[model samples]
Target: MQPISPIGVVRGGRRQVHEDGWGSVVSRIDLDPAVFDVSATSGLDAYSHIEVVFVFHLATRTCTGTQHPRGNTDWPLSGILAQRAPNRPNHLGVSVCGLAAVDGLTLTVHGLDAIDGSPVLDVKPYLPEFAPRGEVRGPAYAGELMRDYF
Candidate 1:
């Protein structure tokens, strides 16, 4: 398989990684002009939200075992895949955030958790049809961990 390439770069958000308090952060994703034209985002403004697929470019670890979420001992240990920790293999992160505006090839978004200068792999409109079916359940700790994550 060919290696993945970033279609855009994040800007004007948190400069460093933080576990929480990302609710109001506004960011801009500038699509590479060499690869994308303004028409690429022509119809994207219709969506109220979007799902951003980005690389955790600063993640230094590739943990593959069970660990407490956010190093909080109060939470139960879970496999790397069970949590959204950045230390896992592949360093991929996905967030469904509010779409603020789409200007040409530049996108302004709210609540994106990725840091400034992060590489964005893809952006997709958030569709309710793609949501989980039936009941959805998770450990109580998951809610607590995401209380301020937006």
Candidate 2:
């Protein structure tokens, strides 16, 4: 299996600041091209957006159990497959970050939530052909989360 190490920190988003000086986990992610080398595709630049996958290294220790919706007590505790909590058995996170620029192997993207030195997993060009469409269905918490946060 191929291993991936983090190249640098991503800016943007207001993830929480951790006690260890690392910022809060992000709801999104941006990967570095200097490390990714997506240029081989030739059409990588054609897409304005792409998805990022990264590891939650901090969770390497006690990251366990599917959480109750961002650690809120009001939300019911759920299992790994039920919710998108990072504390799952794998501790991996994925998000679609907007590509601002791509210079050779160096890429600039927005909306990544990784801390200053988190490990990156992989990057893929988001193709519309592969996009999923249809009435989106999921948990009934978009409004609940907003109220809980605000």
Candidate 3:
């Protein structure tokens, strides 16, 4: 597989790995000037939201293959792939955040879960056409696990 590199870096948000209270975090994603031209974000403002794909650089890798969500035994045991924990195989994260503005190579967003200094892998406009087509369902525990995850 080809190696991946960051297109940008997150500027502000929770610096720690605490899972809750990410709803109001505002962040700036500054694209690497050497890697991309300012025009890279030219028409991105047309979309109300964007999908930010980033790396969980701070999560310590763990060997446990399965665990209760958030370490809560009340939730059923789930495989690492079945959960959204950052310590999974790839340590990658994706979040859909409100697009506040696009200025040159910088993008201002709301509710981005990535922390300051996190490497941003990619950014894509949120297109409703790509939404799930059929009924979406998951275990009840998953809902509680994301109750405050934004």
Top model number, TM-score: 1
What is the C-alpha RMSD, rounded to one decimal, of candidate 1? Answer: 0.9
| Global CA lDDT computed for model 2 | 0.58
CA lDDT for candidate 1: 0.92
lDDT at position 106, candidate 2: 50
Error of 1 at 83 (Å): 0.3
Give one digit per residue, the lDDT tens place, for model 1 in 15-74.
999988898999999999887877888889999999999989999988899999888999
Q: What TM-score does each of the candidates earn?
A: 0.97, 0.67, 0.95
> What TM-score does model 2 achieve against the real structure?
0.67
Candidate 3's residue-wise lDDT over 1-150, tens digit each?
988999999998778878888889998999999889888888899999999999999888764599777888898999988888888878999999999999999999999999999999999999999999999999988788888877
Number of the top lDDT candidate = 1
**Clashing pairs for predicted structure model 3, backbone only:** none
TM-score of 3: 0.95
Model 1 TM = 0.97
lDDT of each: 0.92, 0.58, 0.90
How would you order the candidates by lDDT, starting with the best? 1, 3, 2
Q: Which run of 10 residues does model 2 get worst, by summed lDDT?
A: 19-28
Cα RMSD (angstroms) for every candidate in the order listed: 0.9, 5.4, 1.2
